[model samples]
Target: KAVALQKLTYLSSLHFAPVASHPLAFPAIELIASPQLPHRRLAYLAASLSLHPASLSLLPLATHQLHKDLSPSTSSAANHHVTALALQLLASPAAAAAPDLPVHLAHDLVPHLSRGSPRAIAAAARVIAASPSAAVPVLFKPLAACLASPDPRASAAAAAAFCELSAPPADAAPFLPLAPDLYNLLTTSRSNWALIKVLKVFARLAPLESRLAARIVDPVCQLLARSAAMSLTFECIRTVLTALPAHDAAVRLAIGKAKEFLAAEDDPNLRYLGLLALGMLGPAYASTLHECRGVIAQSLGDADSNICREALHLMMGLIDDSNVTDIAGMLVSHASKSDPEFANDILGAVLSACGRNVYELVSDFDWYVSLLTDMGRNLHCAQGDEIGRQLVDVGLRVQDARPELVHSSRTLLIDPALLGNHLLCPVLSAAAWVSGEYVNFTKDPVELVEALLQPRISLLPMSVRAVYIQAVLKVITFCCNLYVERLSDSSKEVSVALNGLSMDQTVSGGSDAPIGSSNGQITVPRMMEKDPFSLKSVVHMIN
Candidate 1:
């Protein structure tokens, strides 16, 4: 028996080596059937390493050996190793493929949860956790009892199983009674691994149970502060952020700790977690977010794109009416220096944020126009085009409120240097629309017209040239209508003044004579009207 066990150990070791041969399945089987506990343990270990799904012929014998090891009369040491191997086999794809195998294994493992050694109990809990829902109800109460075990491994495994089984709301109700114990473990447990497991279970439960969510916050926040493990701290922060309400004091504590992580930690990943937490809590803590602004803005220039993107998103969320200009300026600066892909992301985020909050942001329209103009002047064509599109959107949205700003936009759009820029299409389109609609408000219509019809207009693309022509036509027509209205009003005033003068003369009994005429015969000044044909000819010539 000792020789066979020795051989099985050698075979198992060989199976793991790079150039190892196939396991001696026949020899392994002989050892598994042995009555000695040491021999059986080694045999099961060897089989687990060597047995493949193709070795279907050994299924019956393996099943028999597992049952023997799990039997109530089995020694504790033997049960520990055997149950672990059994659970491993049950989790294997080959065992899962066998009809009724998981069910039978789950049935045999349920009893061990109460009576087995710690290792065996943990192994049993893991297997049961993976079992179907039909096996959960029968196993839940027994597993819940293991949470009180002095053995931390057993308790942790039991907690993990509870999480798996109680995934559904209806199934989770039975585990509610254990919440206090779980919270205690989360707060007081020495093992980081155990605390993480418990925290996950609570995170999952928190969403369904609001009271439970509130209860877990303080513990989770405490963990975030004290835990040095990056993974653990990240998980704790995420739990608090995702599970708790923003107004909860625990969430505030978690955000405070997370900001520390972002500032103090150099790891990009931890910083990412920190950024995520701050983002979730930023709105609720807006008054205090100024402390994090420099950190987040600096992160926008990080070497890692992931950190940069997260920081960018958080920065965008923090922007408001009072801070749009500063935030927008920062973004434009970053976009100017970033790679094309990241620059695109930055530009896109700015446009989206500003567009959504345009009503609140329009008051800063002049600064925004200048920013867009600078961007167009500095960026490459593709990026510049993106800026131009945003500029056009901003222009159209703000025109009704600040029509005077259109002149500023017009000056930028019609620059000789900017006129030929292919990226200026959207800008020019917006400018044309603004000029045509608000030309009357322009202080110097002739200068505005000159800017619109610079020599560069002839060099513009056909589409833009068409737009320019239409805008000029609208301005000209408006000016003509104003001229005609003013001319008619002036003529009516003159006619009324002349009639009043003549009436005064008749009352004084003096000879009536035209005001400008020296002869006795009364003469009226001829009201010469502008020739409609001549005006039409001039318009036709301009066209």
Candidate 2:
């Protein structure tokens, strides 16, 4: 027997290793057949460690030995240990491979749930918890009785098992009657572990039944208020918020506790949890959350990215017409301060919020335009692409609502400093498109025309360059059409202004004047000296 024990230990160690053969099963069975309790316990332990789903042939022999050891004739100590080992084995991959094993064990284990020994009851409850859902009805009554057991360990185990069995919609009906009793346990139980288990069961049941959820809100809030354990507090908060309606007094109590957690707790993880709870509650309790806006915004700068992200999302949800500017500014500040890796995601969230809320939040279109221009100048690559699109979209919407705002946006986009910021390619591209599409809206057509041909236009990507080319052609064509109309009326001012336009001198005189000449003039071909759409000039400029 001692030799068998040594061999078992050695084989168990190698169970997970790549081995061609397993030789420990027969010896383990031989040890179990021994009349000695010690040998039987070791044999069961060895079998659990060495047996796996792949060892299908030896499963029945091991199951038979476990069944015999669980008989009433077995000693109490041996019976408890054997039952524990049986529960452990049932959870093993080998037992899972045997389709009928759990059903058989559930039948054998149901009687042990009412046993006087706490260990026996705990072990039995664990086995029941692991049993298939089909066995829940059979074991429900006995496990429910164990919920009131004197032993905290057994009660916790029973609560866990009951939660698992009661998870299905059809099976949940049986637990309705136990709601008050579960609440009683949550409030009166001294053991945090037991309360946590009960709270989990409550969380699952509350969403399905409104009355039960409503009833437990006070008790869950009480748990959150008094508990110092962060894990228990978090679980209680989740249970209360998830199960109870947002307007319930109990939910307010829970949110209050979460606020306390956010302020008092220095741990980033706990603060993160607090922020998450508040985030879920924010939309329903916007007024209540207003006080914590500073606290939530502070988390955006948290050293931990997860906390920052959670805070950002929560802040985004809190945005309304009243707070859009403040929230948007905070997001932009954080984006600028954050690592480049996270900046894009933060900016993307900002743009999304602005797009969805712009009509309601933005009363001052100028301020909105300036915000986009700043974001565009600061952003680059993919981040710039999204911001630019949002800028164009917001600009067009503003233009639609108030046509007068088009000149303001055009002025901002035409600033030499802004046009030179290559990072603002999308913004520039959007501006170019807008200028072309809304050419008649420009207050000073000549200035708009000249600003389109910045010296560094060639530095733009091919796509944006194409947009610039289209914009310039549209503006010049519009100008030429206006010039022709003026000539037909013989307006001398129109002729003089057209001649003063430096583009005419460069083309008419055929001078190779440098672009952006000494007098800050744009050197382009004269309007009548060369065809605006000539292939030769287009190729020359493109080159």
Candidate 3:
């Protein structure tokens, strides 16, 4: 049977002669409808016919007949198969020829799908979503019921349908009233994936549905304020953050309040996401800088890497050079007593801020050195190998800018195990050679060199290995270039000192002392390193 089907397929392809432009070149409908046929042949026939839009209108009729042929009392497997076929038909672009499906066909299927089976409704929703623009209104009531349905599948389908419908500016009105219901479900339900789908729908619809944003902000804000469960609150936070950019001032104000709530919450993920939102809100609410400053500082102490990463993102957007000194001071003070985890948070935030102001802050060698020294110290002492490596990467970048800071952070470079952490190693290597110079002169000379020659070098793949090699050689060459450029200058001694470090390989490896390794501990910096140039100079000479 399969052989015969394959031959038939070949014959059909051949029948459609070159440049004829005729669509019905084969007997597809008769072969597919043949009952003695194998299901595989039927599936192939369907796929072949799906290339033409005209063949799509025949699908619902065929599918409905298939359903009728099977007794409902039979097991649901057959019903599922037929439904899947219907969904596949609807998802195909070829179905566009019959986009305006008859209302009765859809209405009759709604009751069957609504009776607690999520799969069926999801399939039905796809069909409704694929219908023509004029057919959307006809599908709305059933679509809305799917959203409120207890079945998670139906909820997801409804959300997808809503997202599709809201793509056009004119179709957003019908979705406004559904926002509150979605917000409520997101907060009260255990189904996070469903909420994510719904939030996507809201994001698509919210631009033109300001009234929906206005109506739901209060409740969404309250949910974010109180929910400790990150998964449950994820969409609520994202929706509130996305809505903050709306043209309405009321929506922006609501987001400000939500930002305050996020700052108070201890969840790192929420804090991170919230901080990112606040960054976007910066220009809109510059007057609230003092209030926002505190939130950003608190987020810098979050435990999660991504959360801290987000906090750093927010800080960059919130504070510029005129405000940099104060913001940097706040970060230093907040992270002073913070444990390793908290220090990691601060490091991520600082790195994020650096990306925004690399040109401005990179030149402040002293300050950059001190920050790297602090982060590297924590990285060496802390148990968070992951965070430690990240800090080390950033520390390397600081070293690249101000070799003087290397004395303090240099000890962190040689830990082979630290280099083994794939996530942070590449980042660290990139930072080291970003200036296209070797880290030849610093407080600890061998730190950068050993980082380059570590035994684990062979374990890395060609791509990453190439990256490390290129970055290291570039930094070395860059240092050499800098030396050549400034050799004739009177301040050459200071430049030489800044680029030179002790060659002693005294430290066998990174310090084992646990600084911020504790899962629950949070600490702040007690003091700032005062001799940035000396530390950086030692690292440059060593590398």
lDDT of 2 by residue, 396-502 (tens): 66565324434654765567666556667777788778777777676565556556776767777889878877987887677666556645675654444355453
Structure candidate 1, residue pairs in collision? none
Worst 10 residues of 3 by lDDT: 521-530
Residues 342-415, candidate 3, lDDT per residue (tens digit)?
55566566655654534455446566555544544443233234333434455455555435434433444555
Rank candidates by TM-score, best first: 2, 1, 3
Candidate 2: segments with Cα more than 4 A from true spot: 1-73, 76-83, 92-100, 116-133, 164-172, 204-225, 244-253, 280-284, 357-366, 394-428, 440-461, 491-543
After superposing candidate 3, which stretches have Cα over 4 Å from the reference? 1-80, 91-108, 114-117, 150-153, 167-170, 177-190, 197-215, 226-228, 244-275, 282-284, 287-543
* TM-scores for candidates 1 onward, in order: 0.60, 0.70, 0.42
Which runs in model 1 stand beyond 4 Å of their true positions?
1-86, 89-105, 108-133, 161-174, 204-227, 233-256, 282-284, 368-405, 415-428, 432-543
The TM-score between candidate 3 and the true structure equals 0.42
Better of 1 and 3 by TM-score: 1
C-alpha positional error of residue 511 in candidate 1 after TM-score superposition, expressed in Å: 42
Clashes of each: 0, 1, 48
